[model samples]
Target chain A: MSLHLQPVRVATSSDDSESQLVFAEGFLVAMLVHLSEQHEDDAGRWFLEAGFGRIPSRDHPTFLDLDEAQTWIRQQLGNAYVS
Target chain B: MASNFTHPLFPLIRKLDSIATLTDEERQAVENLPVRIRALRARHEIVRHGEKASQCCLILEGWACRSKVISEGKRQIFSFHIAGDIPDLQSLHIPLMDHDLCTLTQATVAFIPHEAVRDLTMRFPSIAAVFWRDTLVDAAIFREWMISMGRRTAFDHLAHLFCELYLKQQAVGLAGEHRCPLPITQGDLADATSLSNVHVNRVLKEMRGKGLITLRSNTLVIEAWDELIRAAEFDATYLHLQKRAVP
Candidate 1:
């Protein structure tokens, strides 16, 4: 399944506004927020703000870039499909 | 250790005195109890889950916490302890541990044998009542924590915890003037509140932006105590301190 990302803005009530909506086969799957400078060492990283179906909610992991995020999302979706 | 330190058990006396009055004879009895003092580094485990303990550890200095680790090695901190708190007090009766107790900072702890504690309580019924009362207050605090974890928002939950921590330390003469040593990290806060570290950081920034509080260098300064209390809807009745400390 191909994954697609669309840039968007999330009203996180903090400096982290830049975000992207991730879609798996045109189905919205996750929302990733760009870490703001307020995050200090983690600034500029991508944080999994929220995830739907097959994507874990408890583990809001951060990635160095969108590619890494997609890789993780694909893995989750693959796991869901395989099981 | 103080130069004029009369006994190593003074911390325990001070702690008990915070909630209930201790008679002179009871104080002397506590002072006379056998103790083993040891200094430990941060993150040192004093007691592990499922271990049968023969003694209870009392925090003489620095901080400790009762916590449990679940799947994926994620830890949930149940309580933060300060000087004079016996985080493992239940071990005196329940020899088998249900959770882990560890130091959050460099600490000096005194281990009191269960036999001595049991003997002290049996001989001094009033002290036994005080200990029972202390456990009751502990349960009350747990109830409050349940409310925070289950119902309160992350912001409100954190605010409530800060208020509780400050008040607890103040009652023990370890904090004052709306300021307290919050030596734990944001990760620690996340575990205690059951929130993600990112969420904790966001709330902290929001709090700072609103001029509510300032956390830096392991010290938390309540910039607007009344506003924070109002926001958290904090009521200190659960703490059950006999003589309430200042705000």
Candidate 2:
């Protein structure tokens, strides 16, 4: 399946007021979360909390670093990834 | 041409046509089958578990379902039926009902005596084969549901069900363009999917948030057909529809 992600700009006031959050839409958020699984390694078992909706939100720890996570997201999105 | 409402057997013919071809003589025989038409309110039981049924209930209009109640009064819905579906056809051979068949909405049903169905099958062997195939397809669907319940996540199982229902309705010309009448509640879906009502609600919210489907007021529209199919890993082969084209 092809999932296209388009950036959505929204302003909000939070505890981290100086921080800006970029939300993306068009990803199959539910499917992606269902497909992801917890992994155990030498570092121990880690949980990944992939959020739903147009913008992908993650609060849980990840096995993949920033670059790797971006690549994985791009791969899951197929040719639909904009950036 | 007379309206289908004039012929009580037209729905059966339409259903069988999706799986098998019937000759003109056979069609005439079906058209001549005697039936006792009844109007039933929603939630009424047509056949109760352990009861001996002398007739088969063919849904002429509205939705019905087969279900079994377990301990604690929890119900497990086996399948949902629409117009032209004989929800209790197995009763012709089994005699005793193992589960309950009930109306999901205000329904019009045609109850054909077992003797008449038996005579038709005896006189027309080809028609008998068609009926046999229909029962076998029912078993195939049961097997698929078993797989979904055991192996698939709630999301995938629900998506797979939507695909199956849509295709089945489309085969009978009741649905098209990824939209169909669902007429089911979240509680009913929870029973069918073996999930809690809260879980079903959350999953439905996720589905809507992702724009995968739009379900409202007894209607469901698949917004992303290909994505839904992929998520469900759905294939229409199990349905065994003869005319696969979407009309």
Instruction: Candidate 2: count the clashes.
Output: 2
Docking class of 1: medium
Tens digit of per-residue lDDT, candidate 2, span B1-247: 2544478668888887776676778788888889999999999999999999999999989999999998768799999999999889889999899999999899999999999999999998877887887788899999999999899987899899999999989999899999999998887898888765534655776778789999988999999999999999998888888643221
What tens digits encode model 1's per-residue C-alpha lDDT throughout B1-247?
Answer: 2421567777788887776676778788888889999999999999999999999898999999999999989999999999888888888888899999999999999999999999999998877877787777889999999999999998999999999999998998889999999999999999999998889999999999999999999999999999999999999999987653221
Badly placed stretches (over 4 Å) of model 1 are A79-83, B1-6, B243-247
Give the range where candidate 2 chain A is weakest over 10 consecutive residues by summed lDDT.
A12-21
Cα RMSD for candidates in order: 3.1, 14.0
Best by TM-score: 1
Alpha-carbon error at B34 in model 1, in Å?
0.5
DockQ of each: 0.79, 0.02
